[model samples]
Target: MGTLKNQVQLIGHVGQEPQVTVLENGKKVAKISLATNENYRDSKGEKQTNTDWHQLVAWGKIASLIEEYVFTGKEIAVQGKLTSRSYEDKEGVKRYVTEVIVSEILFLGGNGK
Candidate 1:
């Protein structure tokens, strides 16, 4: 079988303030959580809701834009691919995390001021 591809696209609200950091090589990285909610009626005729949160990572120019304009509750659309990495925690236990590596980002709604 052919190798599988990993890609993701999401339009949602920022869950918290974006965290920006600059690397030694002068590259910038921004990290944030995005929340997407769904509304519907349950089989019992009552309203139901679901919210999904995703980890988003932006680099370089995109990181700069996110650092400048993104904030909690702001809406945004992100196009990116999934990435996973392993790291050792404080106790030396290995841990794994998956995040979306942003290739494009679009701010939605009014400009943040």
Candidate 2:
């Protein structure tokens, strides 16, 4: 069989405000965090809730749109692929992170009033 692919689709609330960073080369990058939640009952018959956080990044024109339309607590649907990278921190320790590089995003409900 052919190799499988990696894909991600999520509809969640923005955890925090979107942050835009401009590189010296004039490239724009937008970073945002999203929160997804699940509600269920545990084996003990008690209510439980779990929340997961995801980091999202957009580039170029998408970055601009994200900066303009995205806000903390906004509901959005994002479709993208996963990307993971490792880098050295200022302390010279290796750190790893995974982010969803958003290829498309949609605003749900009405526009921010």
Candidate 3:
């Protein structure tokens, strides 16, 4: 391709602890929910905060690191790309979802502990 695209960056708090699953091929995948907050003043001169939740997936070394030090409420910055897929449910219903596949994760706040 002439130019690169499909990149995303997010700085947010970990909504929950990473859930790790081992694939049949022995590769581990970690899934977590991240919450990004937006703050602004409303029309009535009141502050409002809005939170958006994002799905994040990490594999291999990143997964390992997430399991080691990451936790619920921890702030992190991630560089990744957005991905979406569809799958059939048990009732033959199609379910669609989107996620961010993180390549790099930086721990933030409180000396990154």
User: Could you give me the TM-score of model 1 versus the true structure?
Assistant: 0.89
Model 2, residue pairs in steric clash: none
Residue 98 Cα positional deviation in candidate 3, in Å, after optimal superposition: 0.5
Clashes of 2: 0
lDDT of 1 by residue, 30-80 (tens): 999999999999999999989999999999999999999999999999999
Off by over 4 Å in 3: 1-4, 111-113
What TM-score, computed on C-alpha atoms, does each candidate reach? 0.89, 0.90, 0.91
Q: Please identify which of the two predictions, 2 or 3, would achieve the higher TM-score against the true structure.
A: 3
lDDT of 1: 0.94
Better candidate number, 1 or 3, judged by TM-score: 3
Candidates sorted on TM-score, descending: 3, 2, 1
